[model samples]
Target: MIKAKITVTLKKGVLDPQGKAIEGSLSALGFEGVNSVRQGKVFDIELTMDDKATAEKSLTAMCEQLLANTVIEDYRVEIFS
Candidate 1:
């Protein structure tokens, strides 16, 4: 079995309203020295494949097709046994 960790994050210079809201809330709650905050999504997927390379390719394709928005977001895949 193989495991994949996919991270989807907004591109640079794009506005992150949810991140901003969390930052504001943290500051309001007296969390000092909070410079900035960005939010992202993480997906954990398990596959029955044996080859790491194939698993990686399938995970990347999945991200491109459905898990991530390529125009505004970037995705990274990490595969492990």
Candidate 2:
């Protein structure tokens, strides 16, 4: 079995309201030097595979189809056996 890990994050220059809300609360709690914040997604996938090429291809397809929103988010995939 192969373990695939995925991360998805918003691109720079995109507005993140959830991050901003968290930052605001942080500042209210006396956290200093807080100016900006961002948020992202992480996913772990498990599959039965042996070849790296096949695993990578499948992982890529998964990312492109459902794991991430390519229009506004960037993604990374890691495969381990």
Least well predicted 10-residue stretch by lDDT in candidate 2: 44-53
Candidate 1 lDDT over 9-49, as tens digits, reads 99999999999999999999999999999999999999998
Candidate 2 residue spans exceeding 4 A from truth: none
Compared to the true structure, candidate 1 yields what TM-score? 0.97
Model 1, backbone clash pairs (residues 3+ apart or across chains), number: 0
Point out where model 1 deviates above 4 Å.
Answer: none
Pairs of residues at least 3 apart in sequence or in different chains that clash in candidate 1: none
Writing each residue's lDDT as its tens digit, candidate 2 over 23-58 gives 999999999998788989999888887888899998
**lDDT value for model 1:** 0.95
lDDT of each: 0.95, 0.90
Q: lDDT score, residue 69, model 2?
A: 87
TM, every model: 0.97, 0.90
